[model samples]
Target: MTDDVVSALLHPIYVRLQETAVPAGGAGSEYILFFSYTDGRNRARVETFRGPTFADAWHRGLARLRKVVAKHPDMIRWLRVDTVDEMRRSNWAELKRQLTEVKRNYCRQGISLDRNCRHAFLETEINANAMFYGGVEYPHCVVNEKNFRLYAKLRHGLGDVDLKDATLVWMFSSRGFFLDKERPDEVHEIAGPGRSAGCRIVEALDDDLLSKVIKSSSTFLTGQVGDDGRFIYGWHPCFDREIQAYNSLRHASTTYAMIEAWEVTQDAALWAAIERSLAWLLREAICTVTLPDGTEAAFLVDVGNEIKLGANAVAILAFTQHAVVGGCIDHLPLLEKLAQGVLHMQQSKDGSFVHVLNYPDLTVKEAFRTIYYEGEAAFGLMRLYSLTGDERWLSAVEKAFDHFIAKEHWRHNDHWLSYCVNELTRYRPQERYLRFGIENVRDHLDFVLNRITTFPTLLELMMASEAMLARIEAMPDMRHLLGEIDLSKFHRALHFRARYLLNGYFWPELAMFYAKPQRIVGSFFIRHHAFRVRIDDVEHYLSGMVAYRSKLIGNSNRVRKAEATV
Candidate 1:
C-alpha cells in the first residue's frame, strides 16, 4: 500500500483520538494505534484505534467486530487477515518519512477546508498589519510553534514510556493495516482531487474541534481572566503571543463574572476584586491626558465606553452598590465624589444624560448614544438619592426625568426604559411620579402587546410590566389607571414574568407587588389618575432600595420609607 493511501484513512481518526483525550482540566494523555492491511494487488486499508486505555478499548472493539462477522459469512471474506508484524517491519522507516511529510505539509502551512478556500485550520503565520487597538502588550514573545516543538522535545528527552508507546503504535498502524481498502493506483489517481477537497474538509473539522475544546475549557475555567487580560477561549495556544491579551474583551467578560459573583456570594474577596477593577478603570482606563490649550481629553479605554452606556453604568453601579451593601458605607463619600464626576460628564442641560461622550473632555456629538446613557444615569442618580437623601442627587434625577418627559422618549418597548421607570418609582413615589410612571407603563405594555413577538422581548416586557404593576398597587388609588389594560394580556405578561423574570435576588420584590391587595381611596371620576404598590415586600426590596438610596441621597428614614413603598 502507498503512503498516501495509508494517510488518507488514518490521519482523521488519529486527530479525533487526540481530541477525545482532552481532559477536564485541559491536560491529558492520548494513545493512538494505527494498523495497516494489504492485498497482493497492492491495495491497503489503514485503521486507527485511539483512547486513554488503548489495549482495553481495542480488545472491546475486536470482540464486537468478531460477533458482527459471525452473523454474516460474506463479511468475513471482505475482512482478510494479513501479517501485521511483517508489514510493520517492512514499512517502519517509510511510515516515519510519511508522518514527517504530513506534519510539514498540513500542520506547518495550515490546511484549507473548502472549494472556496475561505476557511483554514491552525494558522501559524502572523498578519503583520493587525493593529494593537487596546490593552497592555507583552513584547518579544516566542511563537506557538516554538513552544509546541520545545514541549515535544522535552517529552522525547525524558524517554517517557507513554510517548514511546504512542509513537510505536502510530508507526505500526501506518504500515500494518490496510483499513482504507483502496488500491495504490486508485489512491494516486484520487490524491490530487482528494487532497484539494480534504484540505477544506480538514480545515473545517479542525475549526469545529478547536471551537468545542475552547467552549469546554471556558466552562471548566468559569471564564477566568488570565494575567494577559484574555479569557482562554480555544484549545490551540494563540499564535500571536504578543497580541494575546484580549484586553477590552477580557475586561468586559471579567466584569460580568464579578457582577454575577457579587449577586450570588456577596463574598468580600469578590468585592475587593471588584474595587480593584474599578480602580483599574478610573486610574488606568479612563485617560486624562491634557491638550496644549489646557483643555482636558478623556479616553475611556474600552469599546463599550465608545458605544454603549449600559456596560459602563453596570460596572459603576456594581462597585457603588457593593460599597453600600457591604457596610462600607464610608465608601459613600468616595462614591459621591465619583458620582459628581459622572454627573458633570454625563448630564445635559435638558436634564438628560448625553448618549456618548468624546473624552479627555466630555462632548456630545451623537444623539443616539444619549438614549441609553439617560436611562442608565437616571437609575444611578436615583440610587444615589435613595442612599444619601441628598437633594442635589434627587435634583439630578428630576432634571433627567424632566428631560425624559419633555422628549417624550419612553414610548418605545425598551429594557432601558423599564429600568428607568423602576428607578423613578423608587426615588420619587409621589402621586405625580406614580401617575407619570403608570402612563408610561401603559404605553410600554401597549408597545409590547402590539410590537414585541420574540420570547426574549416578551420576557423583558413582562419584567417591566411587573415593576409597573408593583408601583400601581402601592398607590392608594390605582384602579383608574388599570382601566385600559386588558386583563388577559396583563395576566399573560404576569405569567411570563413569574416564569422567567422572577428569580434570584429580584423575585421577592416582584412577588410582593403581584400578590398584595390594592385599595382605591380616591374619586373614580378624577381626570388625573394616581397609582401605588403597597409596601408589602418592603423588607427585602426596600433593603436593597434603601441601600441604593442611602448611597445616592443620604441616610434618611423618610426617603428610606418612600423607597420601601415605591
Candidate 2:
C-alpha cells in the first residue's frame, strides 16, 4: 500500500488554494489542490489532493490518472497552478451562449418540462499554470463546517470542489473523482461528455410549473425506494448515482409526501413506494415500549439505541395520515401505540416531551432540545387525538401551548407549530392558534418581501404561505395579514423556488454526463455535506406545495360557486 502515490491517499498534506472566481468563507483560501490532465486521446481527467496542501492528494490523484496519461502519453498538454475561477467563468459564459443558440434553433423551450430536451451543465478543472493565471481559483459551494477539510469529506460528484462547509448548493459545475465513504479504499470517478445548454430561472409564478416540479420530484423519489422499502439517502447529480447514507425519521416523512403526491398525480408507482417505505420502517426502525399498565407502544428510531423526539412524532403523523388517505383502519393499532409512546414522554409540569430515549438500558434524557422537536411532538399527539376523538391529546396540546408560547419557541424558522396550529384549528377553532400561526407567517413573509436581494428556499416560502393560506381559508379576516400581496404571488414564489432544489429532476438518462441514470429524483441535500438529498428535502417541498395547491383549488371552487349564486 506504500506505493508512494497510493500511500499518499492514506496520508495527505494540507495546502491553502486561492479562491478567485468562486467565493470563499472567512479565510478566503480553500483546502485541496486540483490535479488534472488531458491524455493522448484528448480525454480530460481531473481530481484533488486529499489534505490541506497535502503532497499525497496530488500523488494519489495522479496515480489513478496514469491509466489515461499512459494511454496517449503525448498530447497538447495544458497544466496550471491556476485556480478554477477562469474556467468556471468561461463555463458559465459558454453555457449561456449555448442556451441562447438552442433557444434560437430549438424554438426557446422557455423554462418548462420541455427543458428536458437537452442536458445543461457547467465544468471546472484545475489550472496548473499558476504563473500565467497569477492565482488559483476555487469553485463555489455553500460550505458546511466539517466538509471543507478536503481529506475528511470527499464525494463522487463535483470531483474536487468544496461542499464541506456548504449550507446548500443548487448547482455544481465540474467533472472528476470523489470517494465513497463506505468503500473508502476505492476511488469513484464522475466524468461526463460536454453538456449542450443551460437553465434560466423564470421569475413569474405559474401553477402549471409547480405541478410539473412536484410530479418530477415525486417520480425521482419513487425510483429511489428499494425492494425492502428503504429509500436511498443521497445522490450525486453529475454522476446520477446514490451515496451510502440512510435516515429513519425521513422514511416516515417521505411516505407522507408520496401519499400527498398520489392525491395530485394519482400515480400508482408512488403509492407502491409509500407502502414499501412504510413496511421497511415498521420492520426495521421501530422500538416498542411496554408501559406501566401492560400496554405496549411503538416509537420510530434512527440508528443507535436512541429515539429522537421528532422521529416518533413524524411517524405517528405519517401512519395516521396514510390510514386516512388509503381509507383503511389497519394501521390504527400502530398509530395508537406510537401516539401513546409520544404521550408518555411529555413532562407533567410543562407539557414538553422527552427528546431522546436510549434503549437496551432505556435511559431517558431531555436536558436540552433543538428548536423544533417540542412542537413536532405536540403535533403528533394532535393528529392522534383528531383520529381517535380522544381529549387526552387535547389536554397535552394546551399545556404545550402554555409552556412553548411563554418561551416564544415559535418565533424562529420552524414549521412545526404553524403546521400543528393549522391542523388543530380544523377540530377546535381557537383564535390563539390561528393568530399565533398568522404572526409567525406574517413576520417571515414581511422579511422576505422586504428583502430584494436574496430569495428564501422554496420549502420555506411554501411553508409560510401554506400557514397563511390555511388561516385565511378558515377565517377570511386573516387575509389582511398577507398585506397587499395576493394568493397568485405566493403561488409564483413556490413555482420559482423549485429552480434551486438540490436535484436535477429531469430524466438523467437523457444527460450525457450521468454514469448511471435511474428513474427517480433525489432531494433534501440542503442540510448535509455530501451529494446528499434527504427525504425531508423532498417531503417538505411536496407537503408545502400540495397543501397550498389544495387550498388554491378549493378557493377557486368557492369563487366559482359564489359567482353562480350572484
Highest lDDT among the candidates is held by which one? Answer: 2
**Tens digits of per-residue lDDT for model 2 on 1-566?**
22443333423111222212232111233223345433212223334443333344455555654554445444213222212221111232333334333211121111100111011122221111010111112122211223323212232232343323222222223223333222335443333222212222234334666676668778778877889998887565433455676778877877877887888888889888988988988899987888777879787877776777788888987888887788878988888788778777777888766788876444686545675777788778887888888887888888887777777765774677776776676776666665666555544644444332222233454565475555666566655544544556555555444444412233121121122223232233331122234566667767666765665677679999999999
Q: Looking at model 1, which ten-residue stretch has the lowest summed lDDT?
A: 521-530
Give me the candidate number with maximum TM-score: 2
Q: Estimate candidate 1's RMSD in Å.
A: 21.9
Error of 2 at 89 (Å): 9.8
lDDT of 1 by residue, 1-566 (tens): 23343344344433334333321101223233323222222212223333456444344434544444355322321121111111112232333344443322122121211111112111111111011111123221212333333332432232222222223222111111212233222111000121121111222223233233222222222323343333332211112122232343235334433443354444555455555655555555554444445544333445434523443444445445665666557556555654564455544667755555554344554646545556656666666666677887667777777777777765544444655566667656655555555555555544444431222334434455556665676666755665655656765544433222111111111111111101111001000000111111111222222222222333256578889998
Off by over 4 Å in 1: 1-222, 227-261, 265-276, 287-312, 329-334, 345-348, 439-461, 497-566
Q: Estimate each model's TM-score.
A: 0.43, 0.61
Model 1: per-residue Cα lDDT at residue 342: 47
Superposed Cα deviation of residue 31, candidate 2 (Å): 36
